[model samples]
Target: MAKLRPNLTDVDPVWNRIRKEAQDAMRNEPLIAGLVHSSLLHHATLERAMGYRISMKLASAEMSEQLLREICDEAFDSEPMLGQAVRADLAAIFERDPACHRLLQPVLYFKGFQAIESYRVGHWLWQQGRKDLAYFFQMRISEAFGVDIHPAAKIGRGIMIDHAHSIVIGETAVVGDNVSMLHSVTLGGTGKDDDDRHPKIADGVLIGAGAKVLGNIRVGHCSRVAAGSVVLSDVPPCKTVAGVPAKIVGEAGCDQPSLSMDQLLRATGE
Candidate 1:
């Protein structure tokens, strides 16, 4: 069990709320009381809790839970930005996903959230030149969560990946801040290229389910990629694109399409 850090509540309202919710959860369902206690209440900070969760979810016969926990803890301790990203991601999920009712929900049950946090640890390893360990994290994350994100992929904070099944992000893919995407979305390369071959998704973009933005193209900020669209070119800011080889359909419909979680396509008159 992890020890609580002192003065955490004074500066971290998110952790405070999560702890409060964990206590409430224990009261609401006594069966999971032990789980809630170990996963949340035992920890001093959000980062420690996150490290435990990540290790628990990704641990296997090949890797011990204790070792994984140590790696995750080291990552969080070495990089303050990882903890910041965790808070941003939790907020993004709570704010964007209707199914997410509490900050604790994503931490305890959401595979998407778990997978992304695991990816963050893998990414930290990648940055530290621990490529083999990073690859191990990627493999375990994919097997455990069905979400395949290369450790080399650069994904920004405040990202919400709903469902998260069959999601693929290749090496060199750069996803900007506050981006939202549903299941089966792929940010991949067109074909045989070794350098910088994946798509670049800008900030506040909403990518609907089954959308594939391939090649080294840019999907500009605050844009919308309608479900099942196959985007092969660059998209301008605040535009909606849909179809096999997606073309501009209309405005993104809101300033922050990702946050709005809107997927409808309105006609010209409307």
Candidate 2:
């Protein structure tokens, strides 16, 4: 029941023709259904659709299906853990946010997911010597999503950014695995020096609300940056940092192994 926006609905006749024809042709196809049935693949297609609509709205025809396909393949391969984490986080966010209607409304309407996913594509495009094209696409996503993430920043897997309003990631910023950040988190620069001049967040780091992490600091693994902390320097592993220019305040989150399906199978010897 999800719709392609009203403004773009004018083209629905053409798109519907093509989509139905394709679906009809693939109705009995085995492999085609395999791809289409995957929840992850569907999520990706939806994101590409979002990117396309945003591009058209901005009057930029630069977003091609070929380019989007390249972005989707590359991004999907590059960040499996990140993608899983992001999806899981978004599901939880949807469950909690009373504003979301439990349907796919948030996915279609929420700019946060759309912008971030497109930025992943933008980053791929940038690395492939398409800087100008990448920038144009980024602008389109920004205009649509109200969220900005520079393509040059490095991010790891399973990054869940919920209600990600005003989130900014600097060019040199590096985020490690399983990092979750709430609204208004900034990984930014301090001065004019371009030499590794941004923050490096290690694995399993949870950045709280309105936290600003600046400079070339390293926030260690399994750490939590408390709400409203303006971090300026390095934080030790297994610790919590808080307050202005954030300093260590409490113990880190407990480290426990998350048992995988294979692990459970081995435990049961089935």
Candidate 3:
């Protein structure tokens, strides 16, 4: 458990600096504020990872490392795609959101940034066989942040948890790139098998507020899940779904946010 914690090497002062920088950056970015809230909950995810790791000691260290490598990559910032997606998200936010300004504000204040980043570190430690410590940090981050992500979940790049309050992503959930989810969205199970029970969100899908997607269903690319809807079955690409058990409601082609000149000019500050 102790092994899972950050090494805290005297030679490396970067972690503290990075944390401070992230905080300072998010102090003002409106888009990042939601992410910051989510990040505060990262500790829970880490704890989950640690618990999982404790069960992996029967295997050899090399085998344990191999089994957890993919999860670690998916969790930590060591994977370049994560950073790229984050940057792209910031760019898109800047292009469309008038209330945001300065990269620093978002980096520091966004719960998403902090939680995701903490997951990365916790994931690394979990992989190294220090499950208890990893879980400790993960739960701490989760308690601090409103966001809750399972360490075992496979999340892709360009994943956007927009306005992510009350959002719960479960274990065994697979989220693809360019997927956007609004507030109060839940990717959950249906009391089925513990393995691979959550839904899979494909690329370029937009999920509206308060939507619940359950079971092992797949939400296809370019699909739109309307607000307050509950998805149960698999949705095809380019479709829009709504209702209790979400059904195809309309076509979802190029449905994106747009920013006007006045809106863009309203909040451009340092």
Best by lDDT: 1
List candidate 2 stretches off by more than 4 Å.
1-106, 256-270
Q: Which ten residues in a row have the lowest lDDT in candidate 2?
A: 257-266
Error of 3 at 5 (Å): 22
Candidate rank order under TM-score: 1, 2, 3
Candidate 2 is scored at a TM of 0.64
lDDT of 1 by residue, 1-270 (tens): 433335576689999999999999999999999999999999889999999999999999999999999999999888889999999999999999999999999999999999999999999999999999999999999999999999999999999999999999999999999999999999999779699899999999999999999999999999999999999999999999999999999999989999999999998556
Write candidate 2's Cα lDDT for 175-252 as tens digits: 986676778999999989988899999977778779999999999887777879999999888677788967776665
The parts of candidate 3 lying over 4 Å away from their true place are 1-82, 95-98, 124-130, 255-270
Write down the RMSD of candidate 1 (Cα, Å). 2.2
Would you estimate the TM-scores of all the predictions?
A: 0.97, 0.64, 0.62
Query: Which numbered prediction scores highest in TM-score against the true structure?
Result: 1
Better of 1 and 3 by lDDT: 1
Supply the TM-score for candidate 1. 0.97
Evaluate candidate 2 by giving its C-alpha RMSD to the native, one decimal.
Answer: 11.8
